[model samples]
Target: MEKSYQAAQAFSGDLSFLQEPADAVAIRHQVLILHCLAEGQQPISISWYKNGEPLPPSSYIQQLLNGSLWIRNFQKRQRNGTDEGEYSCAAQNRYGRLLSRKARVQLAYLSRFHRNPQPMAVAEGSVARFQCLTTAVPKATIIWERNRTELVTADPRFTLLPDGILQISGVTKDDVGVYRCLATNPANSRYSDEAWLTLTGSAHLSHQEPVILSGPQNLTLTVHQTAILECIATGNPRPIVSWSRLDGRSIGVEGIQVLGNGNLMISDVSVKHSGVYVCAANRPGTRVRRTAQGMLLVQAPPEFIAWPQSATYAPGDNASFSCVVEGVPQPTLAWLKNGKYVEVRENTRLSDNNRTLTILRVTYSDEALYQCIAENSAGTNQASARLAISLPQDAPKLPEKVIAFPITSTAIQVAWNRPSPADTDGIIGYVLHIRRAEDPSTQETQEALSKMTFKHKLMNLEPSTKYALFLRVYSPVGISRDSGTIFVTTRDIVPKTPDFSVTTVNDTSIRIDWEGAPPSSTIQGYKLEYRKMPCTSFQGTQILPRNQTSFIYYDLEPSSLYQIRLVAFGNSGDGNDTHRFVSLRRSGKVVPDPSPDSEEEHKPTLGLIFGVCVGLACPVLCLLLLFLLYWKRHLCKRKTNEGCGHNVQEEKTDQAIEEERDRNSEEPTELLSVNPTNVAEADSSLGRDATRVKEDQSHEPPHPAV
Candidate 1:
């Protein structure tokens, strides 16, 4: 335990006394020691004091190595001075010093008897008493002796009170004696004059009520000090004394003691001990009593429970500083700036008791070191803090690594990295600027963005158009520089309308089937619109989900020409419309529909009719020539032998040619056909037939252009 205590004390830097001096008495010429031990940081020194002043250097007195004062030769009073007085010591280190509790030191001695025992003659079978008193450094103990020998009062009738009063009840001839009082202490002893006690005629003792000789008086002291309340009483049978709080509180015995016949003493008093104390003296075994009361007031030094802290804030912001202290008496507080008294103005205000100081719309001039001073009857204390005003130079930096991209044909998403918290301490929000690239005549639009979100989407923008974007961060003081510009363009061709075919399902309904394309993120849905021809206005437009590729229209009018339009829609807007014309027949027969692109072309004219006529006549003429050639060939086969059978080699060649024709006829052949819509198709067909005939004559010699 001792080692642990020493270890703790060695590291503790605050001055604390391990031992303090206490009240003591010394014999004349005897050695005296006043203890004053403390622990703190290294390099500690000790000093002694006497009677509220520094002790002068002397050979008779000196401080010991353990921070104690030693008086080699103590004296009660000398020609020059006395060694008896209030003495205290202090221990000092680099941190601070602490003074030990003051102790009263006095020399012990017994003085001559101030009042001797008076000779008394008491009646037999009655009460008789004798008294003795003296002055001593410590309250001396009194002893009674008869005939110069120690008196033994073993009889029930004999009694000795603490105040040196000897009482004898039922006194007979045996109680007669010559008595003397003695006062003794550790220092010395003294004897009082002797007197004779004799028996006389019958005597009567009167009963007296309890009467308070001295009562407690009002007093005030600081906390942790001692308090004494005096209460003395006298009565025929000696009153019994007790103490209590006038407010009915218990006088706790922790630091309480009864001193000298009935006085109350309390040690280490605190604020809770401050109250009116009641002292009562009651006659033995009776209700009769006498009471006295006095008030005690405890005060404490000013100590801070809260202190102001240094802070930095942007200009035009309200700043507050607070200081709170506690004490027995409410302390008065004052404000200071830079070690000087603070001047109050329209912008500056102080709370009740000057505990809080507030500055409104603080500017550069309001920045300074601030202090709060608190004072009371016990002691004074002060605390300090600093206020700083932020300037434009301290504004947040521009956003880093800004980027932008298109989310759809008309929407663009922008994002950027946030600056570090230390650099953007006072930033409130961000501002984004957007405008068409290379178009100074266009108005730039600005959007205010929340500081918490680093990404923002710009909607309702023109498709296939480029935009320039930049960012700026702002604080209460000012805004930062603009970040580097970034460019992004919205997509134009995405979510294109899919081609669809319309077919009659019934007399009143038509079903549409469309080719599906790969899914795109920008595609939202599809819109279908249809209208009767010649009206030029669509009716009953319907929106379908993005994944749907087919739709059925019901309750359509029969025998009517209707135009249908389908388009894909997304965040940007609807894409190009696909238009088709459908004709419904009233007879319930569905006609084959022409290609959607052919519906826009004009009908054939007179030139197309003439070309069609020539094309029809040429085919008929070819058939007629083919029939005539066949008949002529039959006749020639019969008449050819007589006139043409002259050369044998010629006949053989003709037979070979017939054989060649027969072999060619075994192969299949194809004939050309045409449905001429214009003169160009008819001419194209005639040119193709001529080219084929020329190719057939390639085996013969080349013919001239006739």
Candidate 2:
């Protein structure tokens, strides 16, 4: 146990050592050493290694007494590549071992250049490289220099390689210079021999004009055929040639190809290719350019581009027609009407190189079929159109005299002559218009008839009424203007007898009164007549206008019976008569005259009687007295009787009755002063007859007195 404790103490102290020496360098034939120190209780061993490997005993390498490594001579040729490496010394004790820090031993010698840079020749815009090779004891770094100035690697145009190579790209005339490469290390630095660079090509312009070897000429070809145009040029360095159209359009290689010798070739040529073409030649690095022009022609036939179209215009309006044609040779145009050549008229004109025709102030006569004819050396073609004129329509003329007649009491027949043909285009039908004269809106009628018919019958009209009528004609175009209006009336019907009463009666006069007829009857006047009872006709008649409702008759015979009648007249004629009978008589007592004895007291004496006898003896005086008395009494009675006998004729119109009255003398009859009592009795008797007449009419059919 004492020996084991002693061994442990020894091992702990054995690992202690002294510091080693740093790295070192040496020249050829120079001496070197690597050394370390260690202390321990047991014996310590030491070893030497190079680059982590054991070093064997060699003639130039030896170990010293203090455990250090030694190199006697550093010879590069005899070292066999092992002279340059890391060297280390290791020491150990009974418990542990320790390695000293490594130290490097490098061999050094002066540089020896093997090859010098050679002279170089390159064209402008080419690449150049300079080379320098050398041998030395240590590795060396290479550098480039141009024109005695050091060059940096940052320059893009010049680059320096690790093996002493200098390169320059895109060499220009400015880059022509002398260049050198330097080899350098810690021992010494050496430079290669200088070299010169030469550039062969030129980059300057020359003053010379370009020349054309082959020429440019005009070309003509048919449609859809191939065509070729040639152009060539010569210069110091052959000139570049190109083809272009004069209209400034690019020519493609699909249909039009440009050859290397400046020639243009076209396949399937068309009318669009017919234009001037230009060829240009230019030399690089010189102001030498030349140009030439050539024309291309293509043949084609006539083709119609636009044809004539139909047109319509009114009178006094302007019209125009145009036709367009395209051909190699221009086409000629002409105008024709109705299949014949149209000559220039007063208002006709032509313009636009005879391709258009114009008409001014057109008329109805100008309406016709028009044709446009186009002709050329190739062929001829034509187109036609119709031109029409429009006119206004006119109204028909008035018809001839119109007449209307009564067909019945409530209907009428109307007739007229047809209108003249000159005033109408053509009548298709006629129109008859009828309306009531009093109130047009009350009743209206319209009828349409064929063109041949000229009369119409109006029916279903009110009796005793008037109507207004007019006519109109119609055609396919429009209706004609209204004709003159005329008035027509329907026939009037007979009226019932009027009821009359006797107002007064006298010895020779009677007074009677009656009521007016109905308003619808259209009564114009009234008539009254009377005669003795049982007489075949009336002895006297009175004509009264429509305004009078009462009448009186005088100079009637006393104590006599008479018959009376009253009638009403209208637009048609006299209506049925109302009859009556009456008697006239004296109703009062008569008075007597005084006797001659009462007149004797108021008479003259005997002398007056004697005077009267003497006056009577004169015959002329007695004859005149008797003749006067006889004429007054006898002639007046005879005239009165004749007037009463012919009074029936008074029923005539007032105009005829007035003429008869003018022929008679203006004298009063003897019976003009009859008694009022006798007149009143006669009127009363006449009233009874009127009542009987009305009763008789109610039981029988009415008879109108014409």
Candidate 3:
């Protein structure tokens, strides 16, 4: 890097253009110091020779256009002046010292004894220009600074005048501070006392309406080109302004344009322009500026980032759609089948909020690209996202809706349909997941049926409870999303005691059957109960497991109506539902034998005919007996029928028996008369017969009907 350059004074000695210092050198450092006359009135080769050399390196030369030169930054170690020879500086390369040009010094102000610094004023919210007017013995250099920092004109918003005026755009509260002017000559350097500018108002420029604040807003700027984002803000007593990126110190151009207009005039606009930016503006006399941010959104095609939020579901199921997009306006969701719209009957719907599509009863055909569109008043954008519907890669439907009766403590059996609408590839298998309500929420889906459907019976549950049984069905999904939730319920019922009535009772045991109420919980199996004929404690009470409804007690007490109770057990709870009294009858009472004479006299007319037909019925009776022996099952059935068939016959026989008893209730009195003559003879025999009559009466048979 060449640090030195041959110089020519193209303008006044106001080194203002070089806002900051370059390498300012002095006389002691200069190897060439020629105080002699030019020896001629010619524009000499104003070049610098270093280390006593005739010419500085050809590389150490630069033409300062519209620029000036007058050095005064000199101390004991360095020198700077224009005495026709104060323009040289020396440099030492490995080769030795080199001398710069002495004639490079140009003094055009030999006639001026003094110069005044430039003066300017601007409102707090407006632009300002300051002119530097100063003096020196010969030609002098001038510079401007605010708060010790040099100012520049390369700034697009801050331009410089040909005379020596500093132009500042969007003057702010910070700009109200005092400014300093300096003048340097070959003799010495002098600084004018600081000039304090009393600014009354803010310098923040603000647009009234349809304008962006702080940073650019409502941009009507051209597209594709760098846009200068300008904020139009209005605050009482305008403010100072500066531009910056949302996260950085400054934005827009550099050096000459770092802080200007409280805006960043971009060079090229691309898709990246869509973002937020910040700017600082302060009211007059305030150190803290009001900062604001604006967004830069570029119009472009919509980038669709969407998927089926709920992908895995049963054949007859519904799922929600998730759509993400980037564009001017928010996107609208649509269900696209083969790149087209779906009909209303398909049960597919778009959500009112966020426009997410929903598919009910999802099927294989529901797989396709769903287009989302984002459009602004200017144009429209579209994006495509693929949606897939698949079966659960888990177990099949289980016996669901099973719940234990809380009071009965009985379990219920639950079952349900399995997942449908699986991929044509076929289901791998299924597995059943059985758990309590307090179990972990997460469970894996499988492809094995043996594991899927479960004959789950809930236990340790409350009785008299209508419990809920949950079950699900699942299938394989090659590249399918996971199923959300499968749910179903077992039949709910109230708990009741088991009907443990005695079917048969023996001296030791009793055979019993349960006819109790239905169970509430999922009933996977059953149990039997028994006890001693008179039991006071559970120690004597016995319970046996009977897969069937009926159970036999072998050691039951005979002839006792045992106090017994039956209860159904389930997951929910237990309850006593059935009760029975069992006892055996004994045959020990007396009965009289019917007399033969009584049978003859008491027989009804039908009985007389039956007696007469007995001989004739013998063959028929034998035939019937033979038939019954051959077909025992039929005879059993007929025997049951005989009871119903003889109802009317029994009623007629009862009526006949009633009538015969009524007729015999009273007997007629006999008269003791006979013929006169026979009477005398009868009298003599009667006396003798009387004695025998008493003896005969004791042994005589019952008389026949008259």
lDDT of 2 by residue, 1-706 (tens): 0111121132234344564645677666778776776565345556676775666557788878787778898665653565777776655432223455456777876556787888888656555667788876566888878787887667676655444656665668878888887788767888889999998775332444566644456877667877777665655455778788899876656798764446677889877888888888888766668888888887554466886655656667887777887866576778866434678888999889878888888764575556676655544455555565543455445556777777767888988886665543388888887765543124358888887777888888888666667677777654554455566677766445576654324566666677865544455556577665433345355646555677777766776555666766544555656555455544311111112123343345434544665777865655565466457545754654454454323434445443432332121131121111122343444444444532112222222212
TM-score of 3: 0.20
lDDT of 2: 0.61
Q: Root-mean-square deviation of each candidate, in angstroms?
A: 40.9, 64.4, 43.5
lDDT of 1 by residue, 392-441 (tens): 76666768888889987689999888778776567788999887652323
Error of 1 at 194 (Å): 2.0
Clashes of 1: 0
When sorted by TM-score, best at the front, the candidate numbers are 1, 2, 3
Q: Write the per-residue lDDT of candidate 3 for residues 1-706, one digit (tens) a residue.
A: 1111112222121111112112232442233223311111111112233222332222223323221233232223223322333233222111111122223332323223234444446556555555555544443566777777786646575644322345565666666666776667665666655666656644553432222232445553223545555544335454556655565633444322333444455655655555677766766665645666676665543455553331334455665555666544544444544223555565777666545777676665464434444444333334333344434445333333433322223444434444344421254443343332211122322223443443444454433332222233334533233222222233234235443334443344445555423332333223233222232211122222223465554543344333334544333223333334444323211112212123344346435445655767776765665555447645554554343322111222323433432332221111011001111342233223322211111122222211
Best by lDDT: 1
Of candidates 2 and 1, the better by lDDT: 1
Instruction: Look at candidate 1 and give me any clashing residue pairs.
Output: none
lDDT of each: 0.67, 0.61, 0.39
lDDT of 1 at 313: 64
